[model samples]
Target: MSQSRSRVIKVHANDNVAIVVEQGGLAEGTTLDDGLVLTGAIPQGHKVALTDIRVDDPIVRYGEVIGTAVVAISRGEHVDETKVRLPQAPTLSDLPLAIRPVPEVEALEGYTFEGFRNPDGSVGTKNVLGITTSVQCVAGTVDYVVQRIKRELLPRYPNVDDVVGLNHTYGCGVAINAPAAIVPIRTLKNIALNPNFGDEVMVIGLGCEKLQPSTLLDDRPVKIYENTEAADPDANVLSLQDESFQGFGEMVEGIMAMAERHLERLNRRQRETCPASELVVGMQCGGSDAFSGVTANPAVGFATDLIVRAGGSVMFSEVTEVRDAIHLLTPRAVDESVGKALIREMEWYDRYLEQGQADRSANPSPGNKRGGLSNVVEKALGSVIKSGNSPIVDVIGPGERVRKRGLTFAATPASDFVCGTLQAAAGMNLQVFTTGRGTPYGLPMIPVIKVSTNSTLGQRWHDIIDLDAGRIASGEATIEDIGWELFHMILDVASGRKQVAADKLGIHNDLVLFNPAPIT
Candidate 1:
């Protein structure tokens, strides 16, 4: 069959089974040499009987077990749900962390992107004016705050990107000490520290919350205002223009005047040469399928390697899909401590699920199964392909800043929507999202380039997706070729290209509001 499509050979080394990469016409009588003969039509990337397998015998692939046969499988026969099953692999924590393979290649020249260079040495994609919401008690206030400038003020001034409202779940119900509150607080801190920030931050809040805007932003310079004195109280926040409609107009004019100064300054900045390390790229996947691991994920993985080797930072989370490939990553651990930390995180989440809370088995949504994935472990093994083989540098939780470059980190709050949006807030200037299905998610300030696994979804969701890696699955392209395309695309999107989806639907979709989980 296709050499590039497959690596398995039927040389009779007793590897247990031969994996089918491309399934076209079998003609029923086709054979795999010797006594093996085709029994039925086969699916690409599925396994075939290379030798006689007993009903209870385990089927093997890549020198490791895949699943057991539900019935006696003869040589050259097809393997599907009635035959093979899924295997449970131990988390990397089960073994001592090992050293990563030495990199044998040269790094890229070092292609760099043009970005907004922050005073802190962090590069930003968009110059944004951040609006902070203190608590769930004032979530509506945050939205209303943006409408004031976006609808009323910015109609005349197009220079400023719309104000971003940060709303979340835990700021109201949970105590400050609970895990739920801790996570959101961490998320808030990350947003405040977002590299995309402009020279000024305007904070508005209701006075009665446990978390205060001024207290959270202790060190950062910002303008503070309260929402208690509005005419409508609930609908309209009390501003410097609160005395009367005429007086309020004057106050609004004053605030706008002050904001104009910051907008002028923001407009003056330009993209300059910056190290790839300064460009933090978040790798995300949603609506995945069989083509995902073989094509889009690995293609993104290759692009990920290119970026990482060039001194850039990449983070791939979504832990449920990383189960089967934990061993592959163990060899990439930079040190024993990093290895330990990676595994520790897995076990911690496992315990959290086992304690009668969220269950890991609940992963691999129905859409995943309908698309060919049977379970979470099967899904994770393929999922690990998104991160090419690179040294594990470090890990961070949700709302936490990714401090180390060339390191893979974990963020809590695994919802794809929340995770992808937070990546920008955590300082990622760009994000490469791979999907076997399709998603329309994007960020307020950050640009998201959607990479599809198959041509079907690519052609369907072309409006929102930026790059198409589906060529890999169609056998019309290779991972390296698609990887290069995606790499250059990151630069293009950064250089001021309006992606199809972002251009059509309007980008900058983010909301931090999470319902507060009660303290346990």
Candidate 2:
């Protein structure tokens, strides 16, 4: 690459380093547009120092001090993880509260999609028959019965989308009475009631687990059915250990019979045109790279703001991802109380990580480093852009249902599966997942739209990636261009007009619970 043609991206005027934008990276000794020669081969997405740096000097990116120089560095040198030192996380005390002025955007109206309207006043993008399991002991049985139900019963019910077994690891041998147990417990209960399931709640239990099937529905208003007729909620549970079951055949038969009832009810559901306000969208990112912040995330953030303006609900989670960037969020809270709620979840996760002897630095997986992220600070700064600039109207603890509209910070683990599970439990009917390194992650109950950060990954994983924001980096499109494209894509997917790549490829990850409580 020559000095006149070599391209790099500098996010802020104060940023002393910029990412290499050349395909396959620039070779050693190649001169940048500014005439600074590369001291070594800089990989694509990797940072290049713009000036000489002494030991202990701060390395700035995104106009934030992501890390400090551990050793003396010269101008034009490749700035990789080994050259930088992780900085201390910001103290969560007396941070600004609801001080940022909200952008004066006109309300977006008349956007609508075809969705299943549940009796509980919730809208479902897909009508699925969800089979809830009480314990891990029944997971195999549920899986077996689910396959049978799909093969035998699903074909008869054309309106129902699919059957999903809600399998998890937290049921028996755990300290159910512990305070932390509420997370997984409520997560299971709420997932069973997700709008996508059409409020058809059914539980398959081992009969004697510490977490009883009935206990899962306590204090919750659930309408379970028997053969298309509303049955006693208490009678919705099918126990494998019951004396009525003669053998494995009988057990499977009994589960099929119960599932058929839910399928019958779900089959009766028809798509109705609902306003966009009924949409509950979850925003997440994984397998991220430097281009993630520059392209995909910012585009998703723009779409998030559009959703908020349209009176829809949007949630951005991953506690540790937001912890280091909490200062930027707290002031965006709609009120002081919402700001305090955000801090409360952060403090709770801090103690939880402390108990596990882990810290925020454990984030930004190896793939992230290979993609140009040095530490969690840089990752957090990039990660939070998915939330957009909307004032966060509410903050909810893990597993709790979303109670307010607009952008809500639903505190959850950064693990992709766990975050997806919790967001579903929080009533997310559709999800938008951004990736730079690329992932084929999907959920059985909801549609997941995968966005790629670069055109290279989009081309490599052509069928798996739904949209490519990399055009923004290549100057073929702008962030607003991709944002509007994603916004319309969301409506189309929500209306069942299109299928996401993950769904078409039949790729779905299992639900993993965040069990902070003790197991026996």
Candidate 3:
């Protein structure tokens, strides 16, 4: 293809660089539509300088400075990480707060989905029997029982979608009373209450662990149900280390009995039509690339706006991912308190990273660089696009259940598993994850809708990717088109009318707790 016809995506007219969009990138001597000649071969997704830049000159994209040029670069030269120096993160102080009026948009109405409504008024996308464990010692027992429940007992409860062991590495050999311990404790507690489990709480304990059953359920809002009455909190708990259990077989039998009771309750529950306001959707992006901002993330952002207009709750997280772009976000907060809360989370994470002797530059992994992101600054700009233009109504610390509707910033590590786990704990019934590179990440407690940023990854991982926003990059579809399509797919998936690629393949990642507390 001639260079003039070859595509390059320039995010902003002021940007001095644009990413090569051709599948194999462009060769040296190729000319762009604007008659700019490539100085060297540029890889797809990699940046090509649109203007000659002097050393220390700002490297702009997305209408913001992502970095500074470390060496003089001619126009059309490939702008890789080696040629750029990372910029300082935005200061947490003196930021804009609610300065711009939130644009008035037509309210989206009449959208509904069939979901299982819990007694606490939460909606569930899946009816699962979540077997919780107080300590890692009971994981094996829980896992074994989960298989038995699925094979021997689940068949009896046709309404139960799946049996999942809420397995994790916390609850033992740790500083349970530490200040930071609340993160993991509340995370596990809230995850058990995740609407998907149908409010049936059962616990398996090892009898000796730092995080005890009562402690785990302390002050919990929902009660474990036994028929019409509240069950003895202890009645639902099975300790494998209990003197009454003589052996592993007896232990397994004990768990199965408790599970059957919960399954019976869950099996009787049926899907009911719930208004869009009942939907709690989490927005996240991983395996990102330049196209992430250009396509999938932008499309997800549009869908996020739609969900907000429909009166639903949406959460967008990844603390480090938002740190650099926080200046842009703070002004969008609905009030001063919410904006400060955003700064607080950022400050906390900054100290956390400093204590560990690291900084934000550690992000944008090798794969990220290979995908054309020069540094965390550039990556953050793209990552925040998933939030769209919604005014941030609230901000919660890691593992805290969301308290407000519309868009809330749920602070979390950028790790895919940890973020998904925290979002689930925050009561997200469904997650919309966008990716430029591919990932098979999914959660057992909720439905995850995977969106591919580029058609290349979408086509290669066709079965694993639920939707392709790449059509936006190819001009085959607009962001609003994919946004509406995704919005509809979400309702379908929530109602069980459709299954996400990961769920269809039974692919799920383990729940990784965010435990900043020290080990014993």
Using lDDT, give the best candidate's number: 2
Model 1 gets an lDDT of: 0.65
Each candidate: what lDDT? Answer: 0.65, 0.90, 0.89
lDDT of 2 at 360: 75
Q: 296-402 in candidate 1: lDDT tens per residue?
A: 88888898898888888898886556655567776678888777777776765666567757665577777766555545655676677778877778877566678
Candidate 3, which segments miss by more than 4 Å at Cα? 1-4, 220-234
What are the root-mean-square deviations of the candidates from the true structure over C-alphas? 5.0, 2.4, 2.7
Ranking by lDDT: 2, 3, 1
Model 2 lDDT at residue 330: 94
Which of the two, 2 or 3, has more lDDT?
Answer: 2
Residues 1-520, candidate 2: write the lDDT tens digits. Answer: 1112586888887788888877798899998767899999999889999999899999998889999999988999999999989998888888999988887999999999999999999999999999999999999999988998889889999999899999999889999999989999999999987899998888888978999888788876443333223334345678888776778887887788788767878899999999999999999999999888889999999999999999999999999998888888999989999999999999999999999999777998999999998889899999999999999999999999999889999999999999999999999999999998988899999999999998889889999999999888888899999999999999999999999988888899999998999998
**Candidate 3 backbone collisions, by pair:** none
Tens-digit lDDT track of model 3 for 395-440 = 9999999998899999999999999999999999999999887899
